[model samples]
Target: MSQTLISPGISVANDDKQRLGPRTRFGLLASITVTFLAGSSVPTPLYPIYQDQWHFTAMGISFIFSIYAISVLAGLLVFGRLSDYVGRRSVLLWTTVLQLVAMYMLGVADGFTDLVLGRLIQGVSTGAAVPAVGAALIDLNHKRGAVVNALTPAIGSAVGALMGSVFAQALPYPTHTVFAALAFILVIQGVGLLLMRDIRAKIPGAARSLIPQFSIPVDVRGPMIIASSLFVAGWAVAGFFASMGPRLIEQLFALPASWAGGLVLAAFAGSGVAAIGAFVTRSMHTLAWIGALGLLIGMAMVLVSLITGSLTPFVFGVVISGAGFGAGFQGGIRLVLSKSRAEEVAGVLSVAFLCCYLGMGVPAMIAGYAVASGHGIFDTAIVFAILVMSLSFIAVYRMISGGSRV
Candidate 1:
């Protein structure tokens, strides 16, 4: 009964034979991941407030969002590779501290630069957290089922998005409260991380380093490319829903920010159910293509909503698009996890998330800039939806083609 945390690469394949209780570990890992990811969306419902108070345009909002995603990417590129070298709990503890810094900066910021800087820190925290948390889930897994690891992250992400919106709309301190609550959660996580039975520092060096680890090995390229494409498309749908959906609701449907928050919740709720269904039935890949089609239809729905100016269609579109996003994202994770060894799991998942956050960040920035330059929000939203649809279809085609070849 060794209590040391298992390092992915150390080849202790037989030396570490301890069995972590499935239910307890799953619960702990799920809570940690949900908390880590929830911080990303804490600012979603408040962007409009920033816009009004700061007199910043939509592009400014996109820049703000991009800072978070970019930091996440940087974390993935650098810290993700290290998770394979270090133990998972150590990375999670560091991530919690980084997240606290991000929340504190946002809470105390007095100007636009402060907001951007806070988001940048937030992105780094999220980047650090994802690989560590995702790897931890896989490490604890003893079940024959791989979907648990994949679905756990998706479920956690959706719950994070949902909770952030609910609290932002319902809580008293609109600007400061969410960050404060998140900071409190991080403190709890940091403590919990310390208490966890397995906290081994696998990588022995003079100092912990932060350097980007790139260069795909020849053998990993095919699956990695597939995983990358799947995430890019799946996350593009998420980006549109996050960045454009709010503006569309405010302008077209005349809904309050709270109502828009509800829409965001509905999207995540629907997607969460779909992901659970995938987990139960083991339909991750099968349902993924269907979700792609759902994305296509959802994109068309957005276009129609713009043309007809119907709130119902737009709301329905969000839910539909969300289902597609969840299925594809989770499914892609399943495909990669199925092929990877336990040691490589975190590195691959980190790459997938890097693609996902990038998809979510970059395109939204483009659309946000267009909106800032006097293009109608409706026009920007529609165009963004169309691009997502196209990219998703291409990914779907690749999945289908690869399946047929196999």
Candidate 2:
């Protein structure tokens, strides 16, 4: 089954035209994956600067952030399966172009409207590209691809947040420099993608594929349900940090350094990357259990830090929670995809990511509104931590009680 998926419908003549070896193709695709996600997070550390310059309300900031998630969801629904129908390379190329355009818009953004529009475009590009590239990775090497898919989000996000912070603090134009740099990288990646091959054959029903759909194969549904909590718990924590971490840093720790929020986010995401690498060899169930426990303990420490207004413990909590986030998310991906077929890759991955973005976008939006509605950042953080901790507890119970058994 895996062999067929990797070499579907390629004749001798087509193979002769292939420009890069499988290893090279995989490397390019992996880099593209990392870059796409990095672009999405590049703006996270810049949000505080935007607020300071434009004086946008917390609700307004939330709207800006949530708009990206909403657009990504729309893109996912509309284009998720298009790659399976048309081809992975085609979808990826077009989306990379869209991402380039988004970076330009964001670089020049002078106001809230511009920021919102740029984020919308960025979101759509991500939506369309995620499943295509994801499917392509699996096609190239299922085992490595799955691991790369699991690791890229954390790695990309960590790099983006940290880079943005560093550039913002050190460069002349904080906002413009990062976007421009990212745009340049995208340009290079787009050219590289042209040299790559689309291993998946173009199936019939291309037009119908444009219609929005979400599905998990019958065999995958049970694992999907079991992994859903892990998705929510992990990403909800991420969403909180991305959208509100900077503000939390300012309000709670009385630190006004631009790099502080980005540092915290980098630590959180970087730790997750480390955790995924550390536990990549573990069984899916074991990874899930570890992730759940990490989330529970980490969130508890975070809550304590918030209550005591201790920055050190808060940082420690962030790192621990980040590890859980990575491990749990990776475990969830492995669990759901464990039973999926090659043809089902795009749809399954799309649904899986849909759950992820929902977890990432919704709670942050709610927190934004809550803060705007007179709940202080600390108060909101406490409430958010408690909620995530509760979810983590549920995930732990589910994993331990054999509820996730397929």
Candidate 3:
């Protein structure tokens, strides 16, 4: 009903509600951020079903999936620094609005094209919102960097995947139901965000902020590259999981209607959440080791499972590697944040995310094309692991060799 944008720097909370302390506010904001990210991957478990019903090939499926990464890349390249010039609340609120529109599109999707459109919009909304939301968490809690960002998205992805898969299996409408429920939840989150007070000071000239800058100041490049490396490795692995995982499960385990795919994804994200929580107060250096080791072990397990056609080893691999993914992501971000100025926080992180999603999207598209070209899934997956595994080693080497700041 209210169309007002709630101009920047103004408190939206009522006088009585303003009495709540900063910690409570942080928790609320963090929860909202998680909800925002959770919807990003809800469609993961449903991919196999789409393939069957829509008769889309592996490349088609990969194309639909990869579009999200591309759209997000575009958003980041353009609007990534927007939150730096605008207030965090304004950026975050706009993300919710965009998310709501994406969810509605997803809920009403009829064919493969609709799925493509839905994911495309979803990517843009998610990309624009994440930097701001991540910045807000760090802004609220100075000590929070990787742990908060890692834990929130991990929790969100896990819960969203698990819930979407469960509803698809149990509900009457399946896809429609999940999207509808998500839209409803986002509506609630949107209201909460609208009512929340702005925490950051608003800069003037936000209206004229249209240069499309991807600023990587000289001082921040080393940490940014290091972060980008880890992000590529982490998200490349995710590319395998999100794009090919269900089909992998179906072919190997013989469960074509695969909730196992979602479970594996959940395990990956949940383990990451757990690891970050356990080491919340620890240094990024420690998390880097944990991430590297976990990734190596996890990738090995995944290979073994694929080779043997066993589900147990695959589950073990996904869980362990997911911890690595979470750690690498957080460690990299935290490492960068340690070097970042307040004004440059969102922009720097946006570049980091751009690298990460490129890793997530591009490799998976290749894999999809690989499958479409009649390559054995196991062989293609092995190649993917080899590339990502090399990065893991590099991360470890850098972490230990005192070149970690790279």
lDDT: worst 10-residue window of model 1:
9-18
TM-score versus the correct structure, for each prediction: 0.88, 0.96, 0.91
For candidate 1, give the lDDT of residue 311.
73
Question: Which sections of candidate 3 miss by over 4 Å?
Answer: 1-21, 401-406
TM-score of 1: 0.88
Candidate 1 achieves a global lDDT of 0.68
- Model 3, 1-406: lDDT tens digits are 1222222323233334444466766776777667766676778888877777888898897898899889888878777777767778788788778888888888888899888898888888788888887777776665664467767877887887787679768777777888888888888767776767666656676755546676787877777666676788888887778778888777788874448777777778888888787777777777777788888889988888877888888888888899888887788878887777766777787888898889989999999999999998778888888788888888777666655445
lDDT of 2 by residue, 31-66 (tens): 888898888777877888999999999898889989
Residues 1-406, candidate 1: write the lDDT tens digits: 3344344433332323434444555566677776766666656677777777889877887888777778889888878866666677667778788788888999887779999998887778778777777776667652423555545555655665665566667777667877787788778767766666553346554134356655554545665565566577667766655656566677887887644753564465456457546544655467566557767777678678888998778777776776766666666767666667776676777777878888988998888889889998877877776787787778777767775432
- After superposing candidate 1, which stretches have Cα over 4 Å from the reference? 1-22, 142-149, 199-211, 217-220
